[model samples]
Target chain A: MNAPVLAVRNLTKLFADAARPDAMPVGVRGVSLEVARGEVVGLIGESGCGKTTLGRCIARLLDPDSGEVLVRDVPFSALKGHSLRNFRKNVQVVFQKPETCLNPRMTVAVFVREALRNFGIVANNAEARKRLVELASLVGLREAALEQYPHQLSGGERQRVAIMRALACEPELIVLDEPTSALDVSVQAQVLRTLKDLQTVVGTSFLFISHDVAVIRYMCARVLVMYLGVVVEEGPVEAVFGRPAHPYTRALLAAAPRIKPRAVDPIALRGELMLGDVRLDECPVRVRCPLAHARCVEAPPEFDLGDGHRSACWLSADTASRSVSPTAMKAAS
Target chain B: MSADAPLFQIDGLTIDSIRADRRRRIVQDVSLCVAPGQIYGLVGESGSGKSVSMMASVGLATTGLAVQAGTVRFGGVVQQAVDQRGLKQNLSHGISLLFQNAKGALSPFLATGAQVGRVLDRQAIPRADREARISELFRVVGLNHADLGGKYPHQISGGQAQRVAMACALATDPKLLIADEPTTALDVTTEREMLRFLKRLCEDRGLAIILVAHNLSLVSEYCSGLSILHAGQVVEDGDLGAIFDEPLHPYTQGLIAAVPDVDEPHELIPIAGSVWGGSADIDRCRFSHRCPFAMPRCDAGIPTGIRTRGRNVHCVLYDEAAS
Candidate 1:
């Protein structure tokens, strides 16, 4: 098999709260994942769940406290100076807010050309202009928009420019952090379609990070459901969203509003999410889980559910041992 | 007022923005009716005039904007919408507003309890009963009064702060509440909880709510009736179920198709162009420029509302005389 484009193992990044020393730090915790070449992997969670932190760590924008990030089997930490600069070309990031990331003074063409020149993707000005036009069309940007500044562009156009800049490097992997959340529904659809088409045409792996469940389901072949800095569930999109094993995942799916009214009542959780309320030794979601049990006091290990599906919950063990369905278990609880 | 009469109604509401001595109609011929205990949704994108129309209906249209025409009826009392003084009086008559950003709307210097108390004070509840009413309002909104009352806005979570805003809105025992994108700042779970709570409030108190939002799915889940606004004009209005089942307007169809569904994945077909805010005096369909089926006559005049499929749709395609 060909090597995966990006591989992360036991990645941990914690931010210390100096004002509240006793409070648990907020950031990504011991995350492990693999993004095969041309694969779209989704990371979904509510605010402060560390999905963004994980994306930043994978993109090397922020250094993780421990663990390894590998690009095509090459350790990200081992690269230095010129080698690191060359290696960085393999991964790119598109932030949530394009306005802040884009330079206000540069036209769309100049902004994209900067990436090309920095990576030496184009040798001459003529080639750079040609590449800029190609990248713009690839991302569904009008050739005319390349001449306008970021401030002159619409929200959707600005985001497309950001994506174009990232694609300029011809990176093997791109980390998109809530790329379409700020866009209108119509504009968001256009951008998401463009991204999907670009992925197919360019064959670039995408680490799609978003809080919108439906978007993640639409864009990703596989998904990781995170909660309080831990991945509670991971599997094929169908296996995870269709037959979610973790209670948190079930609650999240239930909570998301659907265009078609849901047939059943949403599973109401116990309370609002309170960060730093649980110790690392305990399950991060037990405080809010309606079906939490005594076994949930301790952190559960990820149980393999076949088809590459895995869930970190003690109830999955019961489902495996007693052949009890998760729904039946919930009723019993 | 009769029990069956709409709690709040706005007819032929028109608004114009005066910028550098030039007049441009921002909202024109907008109309909406909300019956008691109904959750009516006003869905549109930003700058589409959902907020502007609602604000003007309540006489809170921002400076530099003029209310040109229309009539507002509250509790069977009719008054011209252009009468800002008369419309401002509606605020005291069982009408409350909840904005998008709860934290920013809240008074930073005051405790949550004091904020709620201030509303009661304005309503002239005797000083003796103000504290009890504040606590009751907190409980009604599902907040622990003893815990959150004394805390400042910054001390509470987004959901809690919004509930605090809800408590303030409810302090007057309002018959009609205008909540403009109330849950846009909240997480999905919290957003659902808030909407569910609002539904319960309507059921328990016979309260009518005007839920203004840019999200179609969110409104579809909670609102019974809705009006789709485009470039300040309501292009579609009526039964939510009917609109969802068979949307008639081109703009409505495009908006629904653009939304991504969690339960069912389908190809998204975005509208071709952004909304074009034309001159108020032009008297044409605001959505014609973006409409796929735009015709030469669509440029002639505004498409009047046509009744079909248990709803009202404004489009040339629906005009019996045109086609």
Candidate 2:
């Protein structure tokens, strides 16, 4: 496999807490992943699963506590001064809520061109305006849309403007944080298609972060599932979707509301690893997993289930192959 | 109507919202029935008046929003048309509402127990009786009343908070609970637990519900009957399975097809146009432009509400059979 355009290794982000001690209860524990040019890697989990935090950390919006964020083999975290500025230009982000993300005062054209002129990506107003039009057009926004403010455009239009602004820097990576979650289901489909089209035209790698698993299933080529601020599962989207190996991933798939949930048993987790009846090393999934035994408590890091796919559970090859149906709830008593 | 009949019944309801320019009809001659122990689903996008139609029953209508004409009968008691009296006076004890946000449902200052008890206390329940009412309410919504009364809003998780909100709605021992996108704000696991708790609560003691949501898949899980709202009107209303199998209105079919399902891998066909809100073209149909099956005849005539396949559809495509 070719080396990825962006490789995040042991990417841990910890914010100092005023309430809790700095050492204990850090936000994001050791997280690791990659994004190849023209490839879309989806980050899926519930809110506070470190999806947004991870995106911010990768975009260099927030500094990591301990880990490496490599861009074109050069460490992004290692850069200082103008190099850091360059790194920022290399990776831009479109936040989850477009309404709040876009400045109410700034017109859409100004919003798109701000990044262009600031990054020195374009020399002058004429050059910046010309580039802004192209970026807007790439994301399916009209040149006339530039004259309108964020509030004037519809929810779909505003998001397209947000996407256009993200592309204005001509970044190699775009950390899209729940780009379509707020929009209506119909409008969301259009935005997703636009994102796909933009990726094809520009070959920009996206770290699309969302709490909804179904959305990532349709849009992303690869998927990464996180829990309790840790990478629980990571592999091909279809593999993780069709044959989800991780207990958490399987549970998420089962718990996800089906198109038609006639007589379907809802997936119930035992609880979060930190709060539930289990420890991190003992298997983060032990609390919720019905297949868990005493052996899971002493399991090593990531028991490979063949291929690149991996799970942290201590279940043996034979036991894992048994294929327990996740349809049954853990039965909360 | 007997008490054994549906909790809420509306034969012909027309809810309208007032814009600055003029009065515009929103929910046009809509009608549906929510029987006791039934979870009736209301599905539609924003501006579809799904929220407005249900919110009208609960007496929480937004400003510039008024039921110019709509009959809302809750617990066999008919609400007076568009007056504050219809909501607070007659159906006060009969109905309660749960908003999409649990945090918003609960006041930040008040504790969960206090909030739940507040609903009943408003109707002149003694302070001493409030404690017992709070406890029973918590049990009804599947929350531990044991010392949970003292904790403030921020102290609990979202699922627990919503459960507390459910407890609040149950405080009046309401016959009908109107939940507006209740699960929209929750995670999948938390949402599952919430719905299960609600279903079980409904099963144990009979309580009617009007669950408003955009996703039909979610509505199909629990709802026996459904009303699909579009452009501030009931485009389709009736059996959940029948509509899923054979939706009469093109808008209903489009809205149902838009939801992306986890179990079922679909191409996710999105509806063509955004909802129009200023004012209807008056003569022209609301969904005339966006509907794939729309014809030239649709632009000229106002589609009359008609029944097809046991469900009411408001569209020109179904006009031939209805006419």
Highest TM-score scorer: 1
lDDT of 2 by residue, A1-333 (tens): 777889988777755445544223435676777788789999988866778888888888888888889987789977889879877888889877899889999999888788888889899999988888788778888778899998889999999988888888888889999999889888887888788877888998999998888888887888888875777777788778887767778778877776567475634575433343344455556667766777766533554555556555554345344332221111111
List model 2 lDDT by residue over B137-221, tens digit each.
8877777788578898887778788888888778777788888899888888778778877787678888888888987778778
What DockQ would you assign to candidate 2?
0.63
Docking class of predicted structure 1:
medium
Tell me what TM-score chain A of model 2 achieves.
0.89
Candidate 1, A1-333: lDDT as tens digits: 788999998788888778788777888777889999999999999998999999998888888888789999999856778988988989999999999899999999888888999989999999999888888889999899999999888899999999999999999999999999998898898999999999999999999999999999889999999998888899999999999999889989998988787989647677688765676677888889988989887778787788888888888885543321221111000
- What Cα-based lDDT does every candidate model obtain? 0.88, 0.76
True contacts kept of each: 0.66, 0.60
Q: What's the lDDT of the predicted structure labeled candidate 1?
A: 0.88
**Model 1, range B12-116, lDDT digits (tens) per residue?**
999999989798888989998999999999999888899999988988888899999999999889989898877897656689999989999999999999999
